[model samples]
Target: MALLDLDPRAVATARRLAERAAAPVIDLARRHTTVSLERATLRLAGITGADHTHRAGDVPWVNRVVDTVRAHCGLDHGAALPVFHALAEHGLGTLTDLAEATAAGQVQYRVPTGADAARAEGSARAAIARGLRAVDRNRADRDRLVADLGDPPRRPWLYLIVATGDIDEDVVQAANAARAGADVIAVIRSTGQSLLDYVPEGATHHGFAGTYATEENFRIMRAAMDEVSREVGRYIRVTNYASGLCMSEIAVLAGLRRLDMMLNDSMYGILFRDINPVRTFVDQRFSRQIHARAGIIINTGEDNYLTTDDAVDAAHTVTVSQLLNERFAHEAGLGDHLLGLGHAFEIDPALPDSFRLELAHALLARELFPDAPLKWMPPTKHMTGDVFNGYLLNGFFNLAGALTGQSILLVGMMTEAVATPFLSDRDLALRNVRHVLDAAGGLAEDFRPAPGGLIVKRAHQVLGEAVDLLARIADDGLLNAIAEGTFGLMKRPADQGRGADGVIAKAEGYRNPATDLLDTGGDQ
Candidate 1:
């Protein structure tokens, strides 16, 4: 039901440009492994716990293993082969034992060469097989639980965020949100946690804006959601951040916990958090691989671009980024169903024909990636302190979502810019969404643009603009374009960012068990 007939050549050109833009970055990702990648490998080998000797705070065992392996084996052959080889040869009972031994300065790692490489590879494969089995079980459990409980009541599953800064409090809020009609609950990570090189080890009580995204928090919230799922007769899905410096490591934990969705964008950290471009690209590849194996849908961050740039002028940037994100996700082996591509309704309401333009953008996204579970974001950039106007704006946002056929809709709060939403605020928000959805849900079934109308003109205009921008990106290179402030109006150089030090080129013979496993189709 495309109201505007978008140029097929323009779509094809945009895709080709996106592919060209991503090819070098993908090649670079294949040739390097970051410290986070090494840490994720340690995690997959079943390393857990933290070192208690440091006063700054206990360092994760994965960090210790990665540090030790980097110090001894040089990281070219990856941490897995050396760590697993030590486990096999020293008869270490577990990966934690090896970490403890290394910390005690009693163990030395060797980068196997020649015939010794085969033995190391054999050991690493067996350990990874065990880890993959665990992942498979988690995915199977999620399916079985959803099957027993039943799916959400309708399409465009209502998504709500819980940011209480306390895990226990978040659990209560999450349960309430589920009962209040939220189909998915995303536990927002604490402020600045993305910049942290290491994941916090346990459940944390005090955070500034949101709860710490630790494995214990994930476990506790998941258990509460499971209970609520049975009570509500619907499987309440869990979501958490799998972005930032520790992206790959978070993906490992999220997979183990069976999280249903992850905020896993290709360049979100680079554009918003000033993480190094190369580091984020490499990390996202590994993270998406884990997400793909875990059956987790990855919601990208295209909506954030609209916050920093004008929505009407930058709508094409969203489309361009989606194409790049889609390419990158495909490179990581993610199917369309798992690509939760994000867009938003952030255009200024004062603009004439704003509703028509909104529909054009949403419908264009819907038709372009018909199978993707597009995550439609609510209005935020223009929210004033007036709750009544905010509520009305949200009504329009909800109507657009219903008419455009969004797969997931984040409910907007009337008090968005005023304060952190209260439970009552969330309840009102859900009610607003339900009202619009119930009234206008069938509008899309019969919707069609007036021939050569403003909506049809706008969709084609945006697509043409996107194709032009993608061509420029392909010519200039994505890193250079990003450095020139092309996406979010912020210039972050490729070599200068928060996590630049973590990026490292892979040495010859570099081997990651997870990558090897994924390449060989070991995990399904």
Candidate 2:
């Protein structure tokens, strides 16, 4: 149980920052978010993307394509995907571009297959074509497997985390995860992996938390995991974070190498890690564009907010952040399926209605992102060194995930809140989820709300409070709102966060031949 003891102060600091970061963006993004091809095309044509001085980086182009496609396609995610593949080449310049595009026409797009689009190209048009045709073999496979799930399994799926120092060793661990019944496997990045400005090259053997996020590392892990999926005869999702100085590059690598999900958030870097808000936002905008085009699902870090704050009192903050994140993601051309919004069971279990409270929050998240996959995280805030208590908490968390019907259930470890989990520990965690789901698989089906059922009433209560908070955030500047600590107790100034300069404003002239190639014909 000593393995689960993490310093709570750092987590609390993150919560405070999350509040500051999300409050400002909720309303502004909802009101102004749009897709545009170029700045000059706005209705208020002469108005400014001024305060949004931060660059759109790859967003401008992605917005353009989605906008154009929307004009011609339908409103659903499936309708918009194909066009997204087309516009990703242009790259997104800013959120305004995306909002305008959304208002234009519905874009009809598809989940890209390598055969439809090409790879990176020499010309702009060619690059777009190439990126589309280059099929995401792995993604396609995963989607197929998920689609074929026919009926929900007897229980909720068990998701596991793997962070061995070596990719080869990690592969074995991943296989073991699949064999042990893990439905998803997330490869934790090495400590400080996000802070690196450029992506490291080659396979790595020494990682502090997990493994180096090299292209090779991504590819090797994905392939190994796929093998396990085949061996287990069940779909297995793979995950890695697309957050940091190299966000876009990491996304490009993830898509190229066939990753299933990415830990991609719009403001986490700035609020928690001191990464420049502008830089991270800019980087994230591009990465999400790539994610949209690649048909990759991105899990936002809202749950991480509670790691720092009281889960019960801060529940509204989590909901508010999810709203902001949802709007931001949609602006980037990502769809509901692509939004893996995060939440957790971190409230101290001391409260009489604690379990019901967790259920309310989880259900609220699920209802909001009805089409998206909600990622339910395990308890970290209250996990003591007692393994006995730890496992029981994990069981309750697992039950909560199933009852709330979370799409991605990140299993809680008996050794959580302390050191990284040992492989044996991971196995026990997996078994716990499997057992809960197997027994209670039909609980949701049997569930019916009373005139004012505790779960429904509490969930509604949180929503009403969130609506008020969101309205206030919408009126004040989103950035200013964040500074007021709207998310967790954490408060961060938009302009004051780290990595601002790391954001590239897409110099009046910018180009990447390799990126161009991938955009055009690299899919093959």
Candidate 3:
């Protein structure tokens, strides 16, 4: 029973336009490869750790291997073959030994021909199979744990963030959050860690604003969440960013560590972090493939758009981006069940009918991707350090989530603009959400709008505008529309952003066994 009476033909048109808009970008992603994608392949091929002896920070083994292979024969033919060739036939003792030898200029990497190429491909496939098995084990562990424990109490699960700039502190905070009614805990990555090309190694405690999203950090938090899950008698989900320059690499690590959800948007790196469009598209496809195979739900970053652009004015852009994201995710084998498409309750509270408008937009998204576990975000851009009013605003946000049947509610804190939330702040936020949701648990069942009322009209208008925007984007191409500031009021050219240098056109016989295995749902 949808609250708004949306037109079915209009919805079909919007989806068709969205698919058309994403086709060119998806084609481009298919024909290109980025260094992060190669690094992800190496990571999936059982490569791990870093060689910090060569530099100040961790130079990951994947980087060392990919860089050596790229320097020797370029990655157009893929790094797996040459890398495996060195290890399999050359008798390189281990990946570490190969990394050391390559870094010391003692090894020459080349694409083998004939039987050697076959052997290298076979070995690469085998190594990647081992990595996939690890991912599979983690996925199975999550299922078994959830079956042994229990699921969340409601549809809109409470989501929280823990970012103390220390992995140990984050673990404590995450445990406390889960105990205090948070169903999903996202460990926010350190500020600016996204711009780095290499994934950090080991556990890190000294990040500027958040914890480093290292593999060790992921493992540590997973352990904590598991403990908290047992205590709460419900499975606790852990989330982290699989965005940035090393998007696919982080996705591999997240899968390896059994993360339940990841912040993975196709255009977030391009629009927000200034990563190259080609690089982001190439990397995101591979990352989403891994997420699909690992059974990790992906939460897109459409909510961040409203932070920079007016929520009401840019509401249709949110719809357009969601449609585009859905298409891209589907192309990578992600089902609607795994698409946690994001939107927010960020309307300015000063407007005469702001709450009504927010309802329209939220319900529009709910109706558009009904099967998706929509990640409804709370207000951040409009928080003016008014704790009292902020708390009220969050209540309204929670009400919207309940009324619209949002799947995941990122609980809003009152002291958002004041500082990092204290434990009390988080507790209060949880209380606010629990109250609204409890009081209005079945609100959506009875919440019906008039056939031509304000809410219904507004939703239709937004959908019409979204279809128009998608048609324009389809005509101009998604990249050019992005360059023309069609989203978030930011312009990122195709050839200009960070990581532009890492994008490469695929050559003949390019082979990535990880993609092959993931495409088959890791059965190989």
**Which one wins on TM-score?**
3
Q: Give per-model TM-scores.
A: 0.98, 0.73, 0.98
lDDT of 3 by residue, 1-524 (tens): 67677889999999999899888888898899989999998888877878888757568888988988999999999999999898876588778888888888888999888999999999889888999988888988989998999899788989998889999999999999998899999999999999999988999999988889999999999998899899999999999999999999999999999999999998999999999999999889999998988899999999989999999999999999999999999999999999999999998999989999999999999999989999999999999999999999999999999988899999999998988556889999999999999999698888887789999999999999999999888888999999988899999999899989999999878998887887777553
Quantify all predictions' global Cα lDDT against the true fold.
0.91, 0.64, 0.91
lDDT of 2 by residue, 205-294 (tens): 999878888778888887786676667666677889888766766777777677878999877776677775555655666577667767
Candidate 2 global Cα RMSD: 13.4
Query: lDDT per residue, candidate 1, 1-524, as tens digits?
Result: 65568788788888999999999999999998899988987787688899999788899988988888789867877888888778777898988888899889877898877767788887777777777778889999999998899999789999999998999999999999999899999999999999999999888889879998998998999999999999999999999999999999999999888899999999899999999999999999999989988899999999999999999999999999999999999989899999999999999999898999999999989988989999999999999989999999999999999988999999899999997656899999999999999988588888888778988888889999999999999998999999999997989899999888888898877877788897666845
Of the candidates shown, which would achieve the greatest lDDT relative to the real structure?
3
Candidate 2: residue 9 Cα off by (Å) = 39
At residue 470, candidate 1 shows an lDDT of: 92
Arrange candidates, best lDDT first: 3, 1, 2
Stretches > 4 Å off in candidate 3: 522-524
Q: Poorest 10 consecutive residues of model 3 by lDDT?
A: 515-524
Candidate 2's displacement at residue 54, Å, is: 32
